[model samples]
Target: MKLENKKVVVTGSEGFIGSHLVEALIVQGAEVTALVQYNSFNSWGWIDSLEPTVKNSIRVVSGDIREYDNIKKIIKGNDVVFHLAALIAIPYSYQSPMSYIRTNVEGTANVLEASRELNVEKVIHTSTSETYGSALYVPIDEKHPLQGQSPYSASKIGADMLAQSYHLSYELPVATLRPFNTYGPRQSSRAVIPTIISQISSGKKIIDLGDVTPTRDFSYVKDTVNAFLKVAESDLSIGKIMNAGSGKEISIGQLFYTICKLMGANVELNIEQQRIRPANSEVNRLLADNRYLKEVTGWESRYSLEDGLIETIRWIDKNINHYKPNIYNV
Candidate 1:
């Protein structure tokens, strides 16, 4: 299923990855409809910052994913649905777990049911490495036992299950694309990459962070977006949960130091208590075994970690005013 001239609806299109995916789909000649969460401010998040031509190319709608009728309506005519909407912050999830359940679990059900009803050609359900929790072994694969160490991850696990069940029970043409830490220009400070870059770019010599010992397999946003397109286009991806990552891991401390080296900043790290996850809840390591996705879609990680970080740093530096270095984003 080539994306050219296909009608695509991207849920959470206002967000970091969603905005980038929307732009990519438009470039691929897909008719795009962007579904941003409703807000009175009429804000489109990162979509609002896109190039005028890119921003104007797609249709944008505001609605809640939790609303079945609304989602069904917006998704009715689209050939492909990329479901990326969810409450993603782990810390915030501790404070409000029910919200995560409603938005992530119930919301995903809405997408699956609506897609089944509409007979959409494909539904690319988004999953996170967080659902795998701390890796029990290096280079985790699709068969790894899911351990939800946090409420946010637990909610995602539920959502992933729904996507898988929908495929088995109803033969919904759905596939779950589980991506390891994705970072790029439009990422908010809630993520570590942006937090580090925003602080250093704001001239902070000492940066506050949490749990630097944990390692993550970070994928550049563009690579992840490519994975989404690949997964949607391949019939081989149907009913499968595939991983996409650089297949490399770096500790947070190492990541921070790398960023400091890249930006030429001598920075002191202060681990803050409030920012730390509960000891048992912390995901200590994550590295992806992306062979299945590569075999299925011929997708590969294009950007090296350093190259991706360099690009992220450049973007955050220019948009430093949009971030608040003093505030802990989560």
Candidate 2:
């Protein structure tokens, strides 16, 4: 379970959370390979933001997660594989659901198959709070009912099942690490935190948003990355679903005010119809019960919501130029 000198491959290593994870793995003394999606521009997404020493410590590979042969080649000798790559934009999924299915569902199958065929030590599958949909009960547990309210969440549910099925059917060493609304530096504007911050940072007096009544349990990016590592390092977590969250809930309206208070700005909230999901498709609330994660891996959120928001606000302030506030990011 120790990461020291362990060989690890992280798919989506160029993403917001994935990029941070690569840094953490390096700090933990793990030999790291970062798998970024191949692109002609040769952009490595958020990984490019990493400090030079940390960035240069790891190997970077460019390939599609949907390609089975390429994944097999990368995953063959690694001790663990963290599968985080997927099409995750919810609004875009409505327009292009097939893309989500292929990348989230089928791409996960490719990772599991590679692990099975090549004898990888472990596979860490990334999952979202969206898979649980609205909370029928407060403080949702791993045993809570899963409702896929959107095509994006549905695709993730399919991916989660595929991970579990691999463990049961093929005895693949895999665990699904489910995380709630995680936000921090390097997050895309497609996410609410960056969207709100970008609009505010861009001097927009009126913020366009969808439902503000729904609530969420937000995990800071670092906390989520810690969970990914702790879960993978624990034999008890194998074949199980573990959630990473702050065990707290805040409505979107409350969250907005919190962020604005931190920014010391007064802004008007404008609920745009186009930004709202179909009523039935919207998830109303989510709160995580993280007892099992702590029990198994001694994992708990280290950052308070206010502290994390302060850090995020600072990062976005310096990096706001990367976000386009005039258009809805979805």
Candidate 3:
């Protein structure tokens, strides 16, 4: 499936990864429709930060993804659909699980339903590594038993299942691309990488954090976006559940220290009770097994953690006002 001259609809095209994916799609010569969540302010989220030339090339649509009618309308006449919209904050999910269910689960259902009805040629559904919870074993694969330790993870798991069911029951050309901790520019401070960078860039000596023992497999946003495009273009990926990651792991404590070193900041850690997840709900580790993705889509991570962190820190430094290091973001 060549993306050149193809009409593609990218849901959540205003978000962190979604915005990057939209830019990438345009570069690949796709006629892109970016479906952003509607707001009274007409805010476009990260899409607003994109270069003017790229932003101007996209057709932006504003609507609620949970509405089947809105989704169906946007999905019609598109060659491919990339579903990346969702409520992703773990802390916020704890506060309102129902909101996560509505957006992440039901919203995904709307996209799948629309794709099925319109007979879209391809659909690439985004899944999070968080859905695997703490790895019962290292190098977690698609066969790993999913454990929804947090409401956010649970909601993603629900979305992934819905995508799979659509493929199995209706023979929809859908694939689930589960990506590990994707970080880079335009990432909100709610995520760990941005949280640390925002605080250090703010010249804070004391960085507030939750438990830092938990480890994660991180991937750069660009690499993750490339994997999505590759999966969408590869006929071999249809009906497959694949992983996209660096196949490496780093603990939160170590990652924080590394960031401090990179930024030349001498920051001390302050354990904040409020920042911690419910003890039982915290996922202690995540490591990705991306062998299948490499074999099927011929995709591999291009950015190392250190290199990606450097780029992210640079972006956060220039856009310091976008983040409030003093407040807990979510």
Candidate 3's residue-wise lDDT over 1-330, tens digit each? 999999999999999999999999999999999999999999988888889999999999999999999899998899899999999999999899999999999999999999999999999999999989989998999899999999999999999999999999999999999999999999998999999999999989999998999999999999999999899889999999999989999999999999999999987999999999998999998999999999999998999999999999999999999999999999
Best-matching candidate per lDDT: 1
CA deviation > 4 Å runs, candidate 1: none
Per-residue accuracy of model 1 over 56-92 as CA lDDT, tens digit each: 9989999999999999999998899999999999999
In model 1, the Cα lDDT at residue 251 comes to 97
Reference-based TM-score of each model: 0.99, 0.99, 0.99
- What's the distance in Å from true for residue 140, model 2? 0.3
Lowest lDDT 10-mer window, candidate 3? Answer: 42-51
| lDDT of predicted model 1 | 0.95
Off by over 4 Å in 3: none
- The backbone clash count of each candidate, in order, is 0, 0, 0
Ordered by lDDT, highest first, the candidates read 1, 3, 2
- Residue clash pairs of candidate 1: none
Tens-place lDDT per residue, model 2, 1-330, is: 898899999999999999999999999999999999999999999888889999999899999989999999998788899999999999999999999999999999999999899888899999998999999997999999889899999999999999999999988888888899999999999989888988999999999988999999998999999999899889998888988889999999999999999999899999999889889999999999999889989998899999999999999999888999989888
- The alpha-carbon deviation from the true structure for residue 68 of candidate 3, after best TM-score superposition, in angstroms, is 0.8
- In terms of lDDT, which candidate is stronger, 2 or 3? 3
